[model samples]
Target chain A: MKEHKKLPSAVIKRMPRYYRYLTTLQQMGISRISSRDLGNRMGVTASQVRHDFFSFGASGLQGYGYDVDLLRQEIRDIFGLDDLFSVIIIGAGNLGHALAKYSGFEKNGYKIAAIFDVKPEIIGERINDIEIIHLDKLQEYVQDNHVDIAALTVPEIRVLEVAKLVTDNGIKALWNFSPIELLASDDIVVENIQMIDSLMVLGYNLRTAEAKLNPN
Target chain B: MKEHKKLPSAVIKRMPRYYRYLTTLQQMGISRISSRDLGNRMGVTASQVRHDFFSFGASGLQGYGYDVDLLRQEIRDIFGLDDLFSVIIIGAGNLGHALAKYSGFEKNGYKIAAIFDVKPEIIGERINDIEIIHLDKLQEYVQDNHVDIAALTVPEIRVLEVAKLVTDNGIKALWNFSPIELLASDDIVVENIQMIDSLMVLGYNLRTAEAKLNPN
Candidate 1:
């Protein structure tokens, strides 16, 4: 992989959505798609979709538009999806259990290696054949395995501590599910999955819709 | 609530992040903050922060900058965070159970009224005093209660059917946690929380960083 200028954060955030939609189109046996149709499906303007693809250096044939399979494969390569990314969950709680059993991540190149927890009752258990190990063993496990991502599903209070442990032990990326934001240094990439934030946005949009309907 | 012109979806998406960071500032007893400092904390440029605030019609004092509490409250209001939003989860699976137990959503005005599941084994169980009801009763329950949001944590295969049932009974907004994207008509608002998308972004970012480091 050769180094290129870093893409803007907004553009990086949208790449996965494009990848997902392109894959959907491919699955439907749609071999080609115009930006207009793709934008319609994604709720964005055709120009917006074109601008996004521009960031990826991807273009369409003037008349035929994009080749769905080739476009999806190119985006997949940009995401480094061809490489298997071994992941470990740092909590064995409900969310952790669900993520371990989620087949979607596995399909997208993230393989669940194991789940780690501090709870004695959960330490010896397994979810979807991924064994749960005590938190104390996480550092050693990372040292021995090619762990690429650590899904931090631990509580907020313990996030900084757990994050420090994971990053210190060679895990360079985090899928943080904690309520509090985790501060990452230059070397680490942290994607904060704030569930409450998503719900709040839904609340705001729903209220806005009601205001439009009732005008009160 | 009066209807103003609709804001851009990109600006709407950034509101929760602003709200979360402002709340964190308020909690720390920080009285004032400049756009630059806020940008430093949020990993964006000062100009970007100012642009975002400009969208909200919020301006900082020439020298003193933004009053932390006031800015936070204003953003909170923009998000309609003061209103109580009753929500129901469509699945009583592990993710649904976890969301029902997450107190963060309750703190932000989204209340979990009940969880709906077709599985008899989970139907009677409760998480954080929110009972799981049979899926057959969801429509009736929505009619009787003021349900504003449906947290769709069901499997991807069942999403469309479940979404239709809830929306037909008056669920206008969805906090979807399913892997597949949900298609929403004009009357419905769907916030698709694709967990796998987040992970893939992290993987892409991590690989990009590695490419920068090794240049191979």
Candidate 2:
């Protein structure tokens, strides 16, 4: 893989969105797209889209727009999506099961290698062909398998412990779904899915919109 | 509710984190917190914390710090959490079922009034006491009940149609979980939970970190 220039955090955040749009365009049999059309679809200004692409050295021809496949491949490389990652779910609850069965991650190069649970009854149960193993075996599993990310879906009380267990065994990335935030060392990367926070933001927006309309 | 000064988008984004941390402090029986302490816990600078609070007219005493309960309540009011919102899930698949069974949203004042699905087999199914109704009944249900938000968990192919169905019936807020973006009118508030984007960001971070460590 070529070493790419470090992008601004704001630009890095939008890379995924650009990739998604480019993929959709590809699916619709679009071989190339002008910045104006792409920006229109993404709800951004054409100049803004050009600026973002230019920041990453992806430039369109003077008159002929960008080649969609090349731009998407560049984004895929930036996200390291070409590399497959082995993932383990730390809990087997409803959320965990949902994630295990979710094919999106697998399609995006992250595979759920196994699931761990403390419950004896469900220790051997299978979710979408992936076996649920005992939590006691997490250490052994990580040691044997090349695990890349540990998706923490344990209950709030057990989240910290499960995170510690995964990191202690050399897993460096954590995708946390529990409500609590995971404080990991500098070497570890943690991404939290704060569903309630998003919902709260939505609620706040709705309230403000209503207030604007009513004002009483 | 008192009228609040409009906050910067950055501050508004941090409000939920502050609320979560404050709730944790309250649970731990801490009635007051200095900006320094709060900032340290939230991984931000004390001045930044104070600036955010000051922007919202929440000031702490020079020596006594801020009252945690009062601060929390102010945030709650800002987020309009005091008002219970009627949320209907639009899909009854794994992710939908997980959201229905998850008790966090209910505890946070967003009630799942009902679940809607097109499948006849699971139409009358109950997830955590909330019945799954057919999608055909969505219009009548929204007409009768005060539906505040529609949680769209349907497949990508059906997202736009479902979004139109809800918004056409006067729903204003959408908490979208599908991978597609919903293009709604100016009046509608859409909050997208892009799980893949987050995972991709994490992957990019992990790759960059690995590159730094290897330096080959």
Candidate 3:
């Protein structure tokens, strides 16, 4: 995050892969690893791993892959995941309920400090021991819990209102699952994940890949 | 797909952006656009558009950016969105139901043809008018529906077993939202999307970015 060109999005995208592979190595009690071995686990060529690492800088020893603990710590620093992140979910619908209980967040270093819902039925209800609070308390909860980022799984039509709420509540970044694109300022970084659109991308790639492999 | 060197996975990732832009233009009834204009809408440098298009041996007219209709259709061909891609959702959970009703799928040329679940209460129930069939019927339903892609939003404990079923049903592609990785072959494509991991990525990036800008 120094005064320099931003980390390439592609490089940032690879952080999860690096984290996953590092986690595996740590589990095996391996302290050091070579780029080739890391590449083997990641399905990328070793040279490619080295290239990506070189692009982002790494703590790996030359010809030695990486020091397990140092590499893990270094990658965490690079990803900025070393610190705890406070997250607030902006919807308490069925999707939100599943997301609240989804253990994936805990493993990847995201702490769900609060869940927001406008539904009278869901408000005050607890899922996975996390209480669903009324949306009216969003700003207070966000400030109280030091929430830096939030994710919205609200209906498409209601996204703008919730987005405004997130901004007013001091949220810096947002992961929006609603299909509609919410307008936000340059200060507000928003990532829209239209799931169906994602499926189309993968589906199209799958077909294109299949056709290339089996030309008629 | 016609004898092109495998496009970088990164390229595959960005096709959706291009697709979205094109769709937006189509919806607006815009007939033509230039590279600069397209680049502006896509949030990429103009040169990037030219370079990315050239990678596919495709480009818009020199003076005019691209013919709206031609480019739209060509992008589809590039991404293979023209083909029918039948999708199966494993886990008839709330999230799965919301995904089934997600309008972006059919809007963008992918179809959710089947929903599989283990819960007896939900089995045979209708979701978005799509039947929530039993898990016991998965393989047969997949074959019957000619489904070739599967999305796993199941419980983490059941992920591996359900993933095995999906691949055994001859699905060439699988999307894993569970925290567990779904094992696959070089021939089969599996994209694992851990929800919480995405939140962490957002948090980490935001903090790193903020720290770099405000050296406190």
| Model 1: colliding residue pairs | none
Q: What share of the true interface contacts does each candidate keep?
A: 0.83, 0.71, 0.48
Best by TM-score: 1
Candidate 3 wrongly placed segments (more than 4 Å): A1-6, A55-57, A181-185, B1-8
Off by over 4 Å in 2: A61-65
Residue-level lDDT tens digits of model 1 in B26-45? 88889899999999998899
Query: Distance from true position, residue A58, model 2, in Å?
Result: 3.0
- Return whichever of 1 and 3 wins on DockQ: 1
Give Cα distance to truth, residue A202, candidate 2, Å. 0.8
What DockQ does each prediction reach against the true complex? 0.76, 0.68, 0.51
Score every model by TM-score. 0.96, 0.92, 0.91
Q: Is the docking of candidate 3 incorrect, acceptable, medium or high quality?
A: medium
Ranking by TM-score: 1, 2, 3
Per-residue lDDT over A72-110 for candidate 3, one digit per residue giving the tens place of the 0 to 100 score? 776666655646677788888777777788776666667
**Model 2: per-residue lDDT, tens digit, A1-216?**
458977887898888999989999999999999999999998889999999999999999988999999999999888877788788888888878888887788778788899999999998989999999998997788778999898998878888878888888999999999888876557998889999998998888888888888888
Report, for every candidate in turn, its global Cα lDDT versus the true structure. Answer: 0.85, 0.88, 0.75
| Prediction 2 TM-score vs. true | 0.92
